[model samples]
Target: MPGPDDVSIRNLTQSPVPYKVLAFYKFADLDDCETLRPELAQFCCGRKIRGTFILAPEGINGTVAGTPDAIDALLDYLYGGAFGTRLAGAEAKVSWSETMPFLRMKVRIKPEIVTLRAPEANPARQVGTYVEPEDWNALIGAGDVTLIDTRNDYEAAIGTFEGAIDPQTKNFTEFKDYVATHLDPAKQKKVAMFCTGGIRCEKASSYLLAQGFEEVFHLKGGILKYLEVTPEAESRFNGECFVFDERVAVTHGLAQGEARLCRACRNPMPSTRACGAIG
Candidate 1:
């Protein structure tokens, strides 16, 4: 199987795209987060890359955008340099945009990379079983499995797999309550969950296991990976996958989709709508 960097390069070179956005996350223990933040920020700053990176004692998570060479250099440092010692299972989801998606680079110390606010939610220690993209359809299609989208409400409003249940959450912090009220362990024997890049679901799956839910699973690389490998004809996804950048969303093959962000509410808008005039 191709590595994350290989996948990113393939997607970037396939078209005449100039800018590349690399979104990735990892769960690991970092005893030197205080020392690592500035070094990482300085590296990005010197290279003129723009994006946000959040570091915590638990791990690192964020997205960065720049030239293909610049991104490759960063990944080399991350996977083979000094920082590599403390990282594990790091994966990047690559997509293209006409313009730079972020204004500047930011590296900050946070309580958690993708905050669930649940003390028991520790992905570094434990997470749900990972279901590969190719096998995802059959797993979710199982009669006893409950499919759940672990993303925010705005994200799910634009696209999701058919038959997947949206928890209607405004943010990840509310996910615990949604699970508590909406999901019954007794009735839902096996649970399957997913998020944009897999970080949120990693934390969520861990939380569910802590809550005593049996047989929990999450999409290995979330929707982005699914879209990359699954052909449009075989795709169970109903619409474009909402993204955090200016591109708004992406469809099968990582192609930029038609949806744009509403300027006022930051919600997704159809291609025909005047996104700038929405405010």
Candidate 2:
């Protein structure tokens, strides 16, 4: 079986695909976001790469799309010369698209890489334990553990781990209130959290810890990593995983699922024909 890196490389070289989307995030103290923005913009523009990259003191988070060679070169520079040291074990979720998804390349500095708007929820200081994808099934399946899906309502509606609590939160900021009322940390001893790419849950788990939750755990790389490794037959996840890109959703093995985003509501629809502008 091909590993995640193998799959990413295969997607890039398999065909004459026009664009490949790379989504990734890293949590580390970065103080030179202002200086880094212009350098990144120049490199990407010179290579004809188009996408948005957000830099912050916390770290970097963004999605970029470009030709196979350009993408590889960009990643090389990011992991090597740009950061001064390697990103260690950073991995990106790679997907293919026929047309360019972004109009232009931009690098902007932000306060937080993934905004939760909770000052107390600091992943830099302390966060939940990292649960590997292989061990995720057993951990969440345990009877005593409380599984919480940290994604937005629409993202959870498409798919999530079986029996996981859907907070039905409209946005990440609402998660603080949802946990305050819906969950009791005293009763829920072991809380397992997960999001699309693990970024949201990083802060969510931290919030839970601040709220006095003793045993807070989060998926190491989120649902994307789980689907990439777990076989369809043995998968614990149900339905398609919603993504923030043109492909919309993906199933087990990272294959594009049968779902499209409604232009009006931005909700996942079974087909374009079903998108009737329903909010």
Candidate 3:
């Protein structure tokens, strides 16, 4: 079986096909995953769409790519009360490429759409502070703001905002440790945090607040939404944004095909290869 990297490369080499990706959520009100799993699985299976959709009490978070017509058909099905109108305005971001992107489709039920190890997370009660990109640009430059990359170190290495501090963590759990040990006590209220999809920051911001940070802010949709609004040419994010999709990384400002190989594996990474590793 092909690894994730192989699948991404195979897809990328193909001819351009119109495709779109949508990610959204609503406050948890019911057994969302249980309610939506079968229907969503059936929808994706019948259409032969290849990607992953995560359902939880929080809501649904997914990234799927396929032919424009098939994708549109699936969207109509979803919007037509299939997943119910409560998930309305689940707008898809458009991108075209010559790749299959995803090798399979999976719909999983989980406690949270984006896991943060918060066993008692209440999405409805505690949402993170949402900051727009324009505001982020200025805030990042502000001397007082201590910008934190909430994503794993690998993701941040390729592309991140200028002056953003690396947590240097292997994963989110380490992030909490980093915050407790390294984050300056004086920089509490002045800190700004971010993550790949904003989900981590959402939870992390709340955690930070609980840890006594007076003020906290998160990138609204994380890096993806930021790139959508900020334009490709002027982004401070140096390379492709590593997405949980077939593309691996979306070329932010760097040249296409320059940043997708993993340094350790030497396999195709989206941006900077970390440490050269044997494949």
Report the number of the highest-TM-score candidate.
1
lDDT of 2 by residue, 1-279 (tens): 222354445454454567777786777778988888899899999999998989988888888999888887877767766676535445467767777878888899999988888888888798999999999989988999989999998888778899999998888889988987888867888999999888888888888999999899999878988998888888889988998767788888777788888778979876535656764
My TM-score estimates for the predictions, one after another, are: 0.92, 0.89, 0.80
Evaluate model 1: give its lDDT. 0.84
lDDT of each: 0.84, 0.82, 0.65
Location of the lowest summed lDDT over 10 successive residues in candidate 2: 1-10
Q: Which candidate number has the best lDDT?
A: 1
Report the C-alpha displacement of residue 209, candidate 2, in angstroms. Answer: 1.4
lDDT of 3 by residue, 63-138 (tens): 7877766666666666554455555544234455466778888988877776667654444566557898767887
Sort by lDDT, top down from the best:
1, 2, 3
User: Candidate 1: where are CA atoms >4 Å away?
Assistant: 1-14, 272-279
Model 1 pairs whose backbones collide:
none
- Off-target runs (Cα >4 Å) in candidate 3 are 1-16, 25-27, 76-82, 88-92, 184-186, 253-257, 263-274
